[model samples]
Target: MKTFKSASAFKPQRQTVVTIGTFDGVHLGHRKIINRLNQVAKTKDLDSVLLTFFPHPRMVLQQNQDLKLINTIDERIRFLSDTGLNYLVIEPFTIEFSRLKAEDYIKQYLVDQLNVAVVIVGYDHRFGRNRTANIEDLKAFAKTYHFEVEEISKQDIDDVAVSSTKIRKAITEGQIDLANTYLSKPFVLTGKVVKGRQLGKSLGYPTANLYIEENYKIIPKEGVYVVCAEIDSKPYFGMMNIGHNPTIAKDNRKSVETYFFDFEGNLYGKTLEIQLLKRIRDERKFDSLVALKAAMQKDKAFSINYIKTLQ
Candidate 1:
């Protein structure tokens, strides 16, 4: 998919079938709408364009600092690229932009700019200043704008039985299986490998520490998880611990550390994408290093066996 950071950069030669939204996680629900956009675009020989917003609306409108997101904007782009979308336009969400009237938004951005042949949106979708315009308003404008409007009913969306909220909840609750089912992909964390206390190496389970820069990225609950880390396009099986080292540290400072099986290298400063496969156990405080090591061995065996089953 061709990506444009600004809507001005997206100038489709052919008339476009478009859908607009934040598309937070690009979860199954979002994919349903994207699928319709692509299908309609293909059937009508029009371009498929997905106009999404960045610095999520809530982050701007509500000043929601506590808002945790399922995927970063970059991750959302990668996820949407696999859906056969022709164009992905990321509009910068700003106070001034949000003030556009309903008609202006439909006309300027959708009609005049995109030359939209058709617009696919949810029945309950709201747009324009203060989100005053509903799907009804969109349909009314479609008649004036000379574009067809395709409304995806609640049923069509609810059939997926997934929402970004539910996915975030599942991940926060350590329900990796459920979250993955909803996402149609594993919950992932991409981060740069950083130096740690080297405690894992002493335990004969040397680990690569991960430090995420995106503060809004939703982190899974504190636990040991079965995961796969991709580095330089290669996949490595691993188990990750997300919590304070209760046994090793006097202060309970949280950290994300993963021990990749049969792997040895200097990964410091390199980025790795870790995909959570399943949760093995909650983070627990062991009485001694020996107890922790013993438990780590068991977790490794379980993870390795699980990886075998997947293969």
Candidate 2:
């Protein structure tokens, strides 16, 4: 798929069939829309384009610093890449762009810039400054611009909305299986491996500490989880603990550490993408190092059994 950093950078070689949204998680419902888009583009002999925005609208409009997203921008792009889209345009959302009038936005983006032959949007979609334009307004504009406007049914839009909400809820609650069911894939965490206190090493369960830079990325409930990763093209299964090492440390800083089964290698500077498969148990403060180590051993055994079932 071809990716354009911004709408202005996209020079359409032919008229396109387009869909616009944040497409945050690109969940099953979003995929349904993309499928219809590809079908329309194929039937009409036009290219398909997905126009999405970065720095989500709420982040800019409401200054919602506390808002957490299911997937980071790069992760969203990675998921969308598998949908067989012809083009992707990641437009930067800003206060100035948000001020454009409905008609001006349609003329500037859909007509002049994208040369859209057909525009697909949800039935409840709104546009322009303060979102005053509705699907009816879009159809009226389409008549003036000589293009087609398709509205996704209310049911499909509802499913998309519900799934996004459920996915976030599941992740925050440590319901890994439920979240994966809604997403149709495992919830993933991508970051670099950094040095830790090596407490795990002393306990015979050496771990790789993960450091994620995106503060807005949603983290699962503090607990132990079953996770999988692909390192050097080899698949590895492990158990991850996301919490403070209360049994060993006095500081309150939270950490994510993963201990792979039967694996040993230098991962100090390596970046890893780990997929959460299942939740094991909640993190607790043990009475002693011996008790903590025993609990970890049980977690490892449970993780191995879970992995076997997948095989």
Overall local distance difference test of candidate 1: 0.89
Displacement of the residue 35 alpha carbon in candidate 1, Å? 1.6
Compared with the true structure, what per-residue lDDT tens digits does model 1 show for residues 187-276? 999889999888788888898999999988999999999999776677899999999988887777788999988777789999888999
191: Cα error in model 1, Å: 0.9
Whole-structure CA lDDT of model 2: 0.93
lDDT of each: 0.89, 0.93
Per-model TM-score on C-alpha atoms: 0.96, 0.98
- The residue ranges of model 2 lying beyond 4 angstroms of the native Cα positions read none
Worst 10 residues of 1 by lDDT: 156-165
Candidate 2 residue pairs in clash (backbone atoms < 3 Å):
none
